[model samples]
Target: MDGLNWNDVRDLARRVAQGEPLLLTAVTRSILLRVAPQVGIAPGNAERALQSGATAEELLQEVSRRISNGSRRLSRTLADVERCRVAGDIDGARQLLNDVLAVEVVPHYQDILRANLAALDDES
Candidate 1:
């Protein structure tokens, strides 16, 4: 809840999307304070509590809790993709994976993503 900045929020969002955890340390909170405003996430009085300290798991959990209220198709898609992967439905998972490459993702992530997609293609 600290005053999150745009960069911080973007970084956090990117990390979250990439399945990485974000630590809620003082540094992380400060960055969030700077980035949140840019993303329209209001920095409420809860900043003090966040500043106290939090783990990446805690931060992710908090973000999930807050975002869960909003009806976003992306969230549903991500969940579906995860479920498909878990269920060994490579084709289903590949179809869901294609949606992410439309955005500019990091090269390393992109490579891994491509590899995953290729694995699915190989199965066919």
Candidate 2:
């Protein structure tokens, strides 16, 4: 995390989406502000944490944890959506994927998610 920043986060997220996980270490306030809402954390709290002199490593750890958790949730949701689709529940799957798309997501991850959503739309 010592050498990490928002760019690292973006890259890591992208790599992860592509089945890779380049290590990351940055988390600037502006980046925090953008990522906070997606991860259910308030921007003010993220700012406060940085203002309190939290190291980039510590903040990166927290951010990485949140991203990991979000990724897991998204995976589960995708599974659910697949089940729904298999059961002839097109609307259910579509809604589930839509909700997933609305969550705070890493930039690269967001692209994959949006693509999945679009594919779902085509299927429907």
Candidate 3:
């Protein structure tokens, strides 16, 4: 992660989304390996996809779709957590986050969920 920047992968996604014919160069591959896990994609899966002769466009599109889906799920789950909190069901909110942590692959979202759980713990 030292030499990796999330923005590089994001820019690549943006470029690909805008129809840029970006090549799947070594640099691109490296960026994907680092950023994929943060977006809920296993680095190994991305590596396998890259090695499977898929075009850069296809891989990038898949990554973009996954990122979108992960974001949406996180939003919905957080909203549910909020609802539980508003209803004075702290245990339910904690359970919701724990359930997400059990399956969520995105590191950023995991951090958020963990932080929310910690906050709930503090309240108790």
TM-score per candidate, chains pooled: 0.33, 0.54, 0.72
What tens-digit string does per-residue lDDT give for candidate 2 at 1-124?
1322446556544555576533333534556556655555566666666654334335545676777766787789889988998999988888887787787455545666677778888987
The most accurate candidate by TM-score is 3
Error of 3 at 64 (Å): 2.5
Residue 12: error of model 2 in Å?
13
lDDT digits (tens) for residues 26-82 of candidate 1? 777766555333333456734554644344344434444433332243456557876
- Candidate 1 least-lDDT 10 residues: 64-73
| Candidates ranked, most accurate by TM-score first | 3, 2, 1
Q: How far is candidate 2 from the true structure (C-alpha RMSD, Å)?
A: 8.2
Worst 10 residues of 3 by lDDT: 1-10
Best-to-worst lDDT order: 3, 2, 1
Model 1 regions more than 4 Å off = 1-82, 86-88
Q: Write the per-residue lDDT of candidate 3 for residues 11-94, one digit (tens) a residue.
A: 888987687777778888877777667676676777777774355456677766666666788899999999999999999999
Q: For candidate 2, what is the total of clashing residue pairs?
A: 4
Q: Candidate 3's C-alpha lDDT?
A: 0.77
lDDT (C-alpha) at residue 1 in model 2: 17
In model 2, the clashing pairs are: 4-25, 4-26, 5-26, 38-104
Model 2 accuracy (lDDT, Cα): 0.63
